[model samples]
Target chain A: MQVVALSCGNGGKEAQDFIHKVFMPHLQGFLTAEGEDAGVFEARGALALSTDSFVVDPPIFKGGDIGKLCVCGSANDVAMQGAHPEYLSVGFILEEGLEVALLQEILASMQAQLRLGGLKLLSLDTKVVPKGCVDQIFINTTALGPVLYPHLSAKNLKEGQVIIVSGAIGTHGAVLFSQRAEIQLDTPLVSDCQQLYPLLEPVFQSGCKLHALRDATRGGLASVLHEWAQSSGVGIEVEEDCIPILEGVRGVCEILGLEPFMLANEGVCVLCVEAKDARQVCALLQEGGAKKACVIGEVVAGRGVTLKTPWGSKRPLDILEGELLPRIC
Target chain B: MQVVALSCGNGGKEAQDFIHKVFMPHLQGFLTAEGEDAGVFEARGALALSTDSFVVDPPIFKGGDIGKLCVCGSANDVAMQGAHPEYLSVGFILEEGLEVALLQEILASMQAQLRLGGLKLLSLDTKVVPKGCVDQIFINTTALGPVLYPHLSAKNLKEGQVIIVSGAIGTHGAVLFSQRAEIQLDTPLVSDCQQLYPLLEPVFQSGCKLHALRDATRGGLASVLHEWAQSSGVGIEVEEDCIPILEGVRGVCEILGLEPFMLANEGVCVLCVEAKDARQVCALLQEGGAKKACVIGEVVAGRGVTLKTPWGSKRPLDILEGELLPRIC
Candidate 1:
């Protein structure tokens, strides 16, 4: 049971050995610069850059680990800007005594995710703190890419635009909640932790009039709608039945007394497009592997998000206020 | 005293409030993209990218805090590549109970450092973990800039090249060591934590036939020499009397039984230049504010580093093998 030591992060021989023996083998193909102060790459156009830090407890989860989350999370942010995530810079903060095996597993996961997304690893850094200074591990990633479609912003949402959700929501949050030490439920729920760029690639190529694009991650669909409403100064009305949710996720949400709309989703995204292109965008997303893609709502000439119930009632969907779950990402 | 709460990182209204109230006020002038998923910037040439995570214990230190260190550290890495650092993306992992005022102070420091470097804040992310999951805070910064001088690498060192240190070494390490809880030694030494680009600007403009350039950071002068020796398959020999060391730093090193050369320096840089241009380069550095800049060593046709003593004896200078100090950066 090899464990990480303080010497591994001291920028000495031990650290170099750790990088060559442990990290390089896993990240061999993706890394372009091995021992330089910085990595050099050509960037010849408008670039979209995003940064994220993943501190999720129980770093390794049912569907993915923190390493995979770090890569996919930042990639998704870049993709939401109508860009193909091209390169990444990663930083790791490891707690001393963390199992080397666990770190290897996480690194392998990150490598796989990077390969899937066609992202090059430009630079990397590691820092080890004493035990109890941090959890087992935390990962920070910065994703950069060239923008394909410009001016896709939350403020672009207009009154006649329609909202489309790529897939089912809340599975990631539900899975994380069930995996908590206090509530280790025996369910077959896996997180929807994945990259969304591939699914959005065809849509970007199709020349659809994309008004706004965003992945519903931490505060989920509800938060995205509220933000869109506020940013664009428009009202959002969503059909309760039109929102997609898995049975297992709904069950966990019911058991925990949580709102499915407010739960996190890694793979799901909410997009706003012209009303005429709604069907085409949904079809494209479904063909690109988002089987549950559908139009969930539309924008109106008011403010705030509203949920239209099947029983002929409406309720305002407020932005998440109190803490629902910490380290949900 | 308000403290960061879990909800402050939940990507909800509370998170928005925290960003607007706590972070934005300090970082207002630097941040160009405020509410977008990713920041879009123009990158029209070869770019140097670097990433680093700062977890220095005692977030606030004698010379600088973790916030300022994060900014300067990444910026210096980019600058080492002969790049003028232009943009930065920052990620913060905060403990749930960390004081908001302390975080504000850290952000202010970061803002000041970014201003000093003329670097724009492109993107930012914050993640708050539960109490005890992390120390007070950890910051990750990714810096990017257009490469001005290409092909400056450790592998470029060759025989007949001379090594010039930018300033006195080991002050940063000594300052951090004296501030440790176990060793609260009363010392006036301050961490040499600063951005090196401004000082290097004139040298870059002069174009004095540079071979290799690196900031002696984590593992200090010894580590840099050893790396350059191994990378270029050349031998390096430095005179002990020629190496500049502050009296206070030398005193602390003697008391702690640590090699001054193995101690870290944040603001100092080691440069390999043509032997003929060494004197001019040193003069340029001195004129640019590195008052102690001097030729400390020269490259030879062999391997490893050797230290020449004033008593007419030579000894092998090994790379730092064990942990000298943890979290010195």
Candidate 2:
């Protein structure tokens, strides 16, 4: 958010000047999108559709917004399902009389993230209501992605796809949880809130064998693994020691008496791919700076997940251990 | 609604049993649909997707519930765009401690309405919070329809298309308004809340040549007409006398001192097609019991809607009309 000329407040030449000089540089490549009631773009690949509403209070968090998160969050879902994200439709439910510049800033953040992830927004809609009615601005983003690879959906989870964790988890949950806390683990940990498409392009380019994918957000990988198990009716076996827990993320969880299994991780996913292609997929993941990529588990023909401890002890995994970091404001 | 060994408790298997017995009969075509986590179906054509939230007050109204309306509202939006409605996704945001029986009834209503509309609900997600959190269940429905015909979005209107009203307007608004009145109209008005797909299927199949389609829902024909004109960059002209308004509907609106133009109408539309095709469309619509189908006006190559009065005077159509309908209740 850089301050330029203040002359853009006027309706005619100044407004157009502001649009061309400051905004157009950022808003280009959106065909005929510069001057229109709504932005429209044709989709290019297999249409993967997902809608998410970002009504999180506090306009800005430690690492992101309800706006930028709104875009990246929905995009990751599309990518997790193995679709090349293309078009996004944004609906803004704005509290009345929000500063126009603030709205533009959020839109700018959203567009910047979309560009970073190599996706184009297809359409946008804005609705205004009285200020008391809502908590600032809430956005509902619905995206359409083309499926360049059809076998990426969770439905294709085979009897055996090696499960890989992208990186250390619980960053998002821990950051959100320790907002006003005295327990400082270092430079207070923040969400790993970022896009995953940059992380995915290389793997797709490498033609690595893959079966299914999912992002562990609202419910962590534990919940996700459980869903995958139930959907595929395949059991999962994992060594508990293989999972990486960052020091800060782990410390906060320990202090709060919260299980990391149920904490959200916005920037990572659990990919179920063929064991044979696990090395190549890890190499591709390295390009995205994910050094913690590890094949943590294997799929078997059973019902649920079971954890194998270092002492050769086993315990059943409760897949629905969801959102242990409850109501973090 | 049946006397089949019933109690109003929404707990246990009673709710699921009621849903299966009463609602499953309405949706017989699903192959893997016997109490599945989500409805799984093949995408057969071009898809038109829509989502709407049903927060209508009274919970139960003259024709439906938040459950019934949620399905119908989303399904109707797809129908308005001339799409063959197929799949629906239902997500409920329920307040905890709410009667389980009430939930069961709502879910039953939802399933029944989906069956009645010949739609398979592809997904259902239920989230709960402690009591007093949620007032009533707020249902968000997302419906998908395959566009077998060309997309008849509001953005496609041309200058010569005739504006056709599908039926007597304001019936839904009147029914809702009269629910609180001491004095009612001689003819008690029930909401015209029925599936628009039954009416749309023939039009999509008959090839009657439609260019633009819109539902006279919340904001009515005036709001939709205004939207169409703005989207297509064309002007709409409507004759006051040609428009159909039911006697009881108008009476209730007059007594309530409300502007019927901006009120909600659940089962109505403003269809724009070539003037030559108007008769054919009207004939088909009439056959479907939409007798009030009238050619209210035509389009001109300017933007905005102008309403012509019986005395030959014209006024600009503005959606900013002020009226408090307490619609959410």
Candidate 3:
């Protein structure tokens, strides 16, 4: 039972050994664990910065673990601003007695993800708390990157602009729910936990009029649409049929009596682009590995978000409220 | 007792309302809580970046709360790199049933601390977890700043460099211990929780040859000294009697059989300066409110750290190992 002891994060010798043995090998370019309190880096030009703390239950999940989620979460946030995710600072709050092997596995996953976008891990802090003080582990990540396009903003959205979803929605929320419920099923659901910077890089370089981009995360696609509508002071009508939903996600949502529209996403993003560039942007997204990218709806006068069914019926889509699932990241 | 419900972090209408009523009033200038996935900022030139997650037990202490600790902890790290602490992103993980009033109080403390450095709260993420999952509250902060001096590093230390203690040490650790133990001491000790940027700005601007700077946190002064000596492949000799330790902190350490050198510091920093410029740097620090700043040691040709006692005896000051105190931040 090679587990991390309380002394490792006591800011002492054990912590230094853990960094040398576990973290430093993976964080080659990052100046973390350098005995210095902070990591030094160089950045030039306009930058987008974002921070996220991942407290996902069951540190390890199917297809991905908390480590991948941590990277994707912050990197995606920067990418949503049309920035290339470049550098990140990571802080870990580990529960005492956690297995060393588990921590290593998560770090490997993080390294793999960082390599995808050529992102560098710049700084790290590992704090080990007493048992029962925290769950297994919580990771906080802050990402900084040069802004590729300065014009992208929700406030820039206007009437006639269209919305495009990068991929299938609600897979992350559904997979976590099913895993927690322990409902043994043959479908074998996996979380859609992947980096989106690669997917969006081509679209950003395509010279398309990207108005506003947001990762459909906690509040799902509906939440993002509602926010954009409210911020832009315009109504957004997303067609129910055009929105893509995976069969596994749909099945899990159906059994759990959850609305796929309100489910969280880890890898999907909603793009509000000028109406003329909608088709070209979708094509670029699809070419860049966003297989299901397509125009879902358009902006209109008024406020709030509305969903129209295939039969032409329309109704308001409210924001998801309350704890859908605690520690869902 | 108006406590924050789990719904406050569920990314719903309730979370939105909570942000509008509680966070927005205080978070002026930043476009956070705007429903976007991340906040955008402008930056150029070399940037210093750092992150820390504060999980101090007893979130509120005599001089500051976790919020203030969160901001100072990260800002100090960036400042230690000779950078101007500029933009910060905050993430709060709240336990269900935690009082909203306490949360607000902590945020107020954070706001006050930020005002000291002219730092902006650029982004914020509030996640509410189920009760028993977390202990009240844990805050994670990430800071970014322009590199004011690019040559400052632990590796820059050389022989004949004098080390200066910015102020009295060990008060923070002593205060936390007393409060946790519920001891009725005649002297009421407070945490040295102020930001360090203001104190160091003068020294940096005075054109002193600042070799290396480190805030003596966690494993305290001993840890920092050991790290600097080993990193620079040099030995450091300190006069034990010359180190500034407050009377109250000395009392607490003596009563608890602890070494003041091993106790953590929240606001103090240690500087390694060229021997010729030590006096001028110390004078500037004292003028800038670090009244007790003085030469404690000098870097030498050997390795490790040695403390010379007032009795004309020398002994090794090994790295602080084991659990000094958990959640001391």
Candidate 4:
């Protein structure tokens, strides 16, 4: 049994050898010469930076593994700010006895995701804790990219701006719940985990005036709307019927008595764009693979989010109150 | 009993409220607006990037806590590359049920460390995992700084280059062992956990011809020398009698059957400099409060590290093997 020994994470000869032999080869063009304590690089202009820690259970998921989630999560965060994913730093905390082969598999997945965004892995740090100290592996990623769409702040959202969701909501959260829940549901449900840079790049380059863009990771669509509304001091009226919810996700949420709007997402984003360019942005999103992209609602004068149901009833959608789900990311 | 509720880490309204009430006030001028998916910043020129995941057990240690360790560890790596630590992103993985007060204390320690390095916290990601998933808290910090020393590499070492240790060795490892072991030693053995930028800034500003610089961290002094020797493909000869080891640390090592050179040191660093400038750099280091700074070795013509004993005998110093100590970071 080839296990990741405690010595490999002890920052000793074994650790150094493991990194050089196992990690370095797979991270070609991503690693610099091993000399200085830190990797040296060049950066200029406005940079969009984001960091996320992935502690999702069953790191290997239905649609994507933790490695993919780590890369896509941070990259999408940067992309949501209208930046081209460029440089990233990866940190891994592993428990002793983890299989080296499994770690390699995760790294391969990470490499694949990095290739998708054309991002360079600038640095990596790995630590191994005792077997019982941690359940398994946790990954943290910090990314830096040059700003492509500048000054797109939530405060920039004005009354009458159209709201657009790039894809079906809550699929990622649904996948996690289904995988964790003992009761197996027969559904074609998988996480909506993929790089958003390709899909959003065209929309950004299309010169659509994007007022605000945020990934609906935790707290989902509801949280993003509430945050935008509060920050911009503008009321956002979201039509409940307009929100796109995948049937599989709806089924999972129904099983768990959870609302799809409050579930987490990995690659999906919510955009507040000029009302006139909403159709064009939605079209670009759809053409670039976000088939479910659509206009959900518009910003209005007031505070907080208002959800208008299909029957013409209005209700306030506050930020999800409690720990709806832990480690969903 | 007040604790860091799961909801605080759930990425919902409770999490948002916790961040706003607890974190934002302390991180003034560091956090950007709350709506964007990522933080935006400006940067240019040669940037030194480093990331470290601090899993120091008993997170609150004698001299410092894990938060302090996380900040200093990453900052030191950047500083070793001759960079002034500037922008930083912190990621926290909190095990559910941790006390909010304890988390606050750790954050306070982090704040103090950042102040010492004059770094700006660019972004922060917090995740709450179920109990037992992680031990209390783990912090991963990624830092970027402008290079103050253009090129510093272990490969730059040459024959006759002098080695200078910034301070006493093995204090940190000894402290950890003492805290973990049931032995009650009367000696005040505290971790040598402090920022090195202040001490090294003078030496760098004095125009010393520093060829290679590395902090003797996990695998300790022996591993650092072996790494330098192998990386430069040159032999290193160290006078064992001259290597600075604290008396308390030696006592702890003797009791634990561990070698002082194999023990870690948080604030200490080893530097290879031009022979003539060695004395000058040592003097500057001492003036900067590293009073124990002195010449300990020199790069030789062969490979591996050769330690010269007082009895006129020489021996090879290989990289430390096995788990000498875990979670000593």
RMSD of each: 0.9, 7.1, 1.6, 1.5
DockQ, candidate 1, vs. native dimer:
0.89
Model 3 residue runs over 4 Å out of place are: A29-33, A181-186, B29-33, B181-186
Give candidate 2's error at residue A288 in angstroms. 2.2
In terms of lDDT, model 3 sits at 0.85
Which model scores highest in lDDT?
Answer: 1
Could you tell me which 10 consecutive residues in candidate 4 chain B have the lowest summed lDDT? Answer: B28-37
Which candidate number maximizes DockQ?
1
> What C-alpha lDDT values do all the predictions have?
0.92, 0.65, 0.85, 0.87
Q: Model 2: number of clashes?
A: 9
| Rank list by DockQ | 1, 4, 3, 2
Q: What fraction of the reference interface contacts is present in each model, in order?
A: 0.89, 0.00, 0.72, 0.89
lDDT for each residue of candidate 4 in B222-324, tens digit (9 for 90 to 100): 9889888888889999999999998888888888898899888899999999998999999999999999999999988988888899998998876789898
Model 1 TM-score? 0.99
Which lDDT tens digits does candidate 3 get at residues B121-171?
667888888888789999999987888876788777788999999999998
List, residue by residue over A1-329, the lDDT tens digit for candidate 1. Answer: 39999899988899999999989988979997889989999989899999999988689999998988999999999999999899999999998999999999999999999889989988999998999999899999999999998899999888989999999999999999999898887679999999999999999999889999999998999999999899889999999999999999989988899999999999999999999999999999999989999999999988899999989799998678888878887
Q: Of the candidates numbered 1 and 2, which has the greater TM-score value? A: 1
Candidate 1 Cα errors over 4 Å, as ranges: none
TM-score of each: 0.99, 0.79, 0.97, 0.97
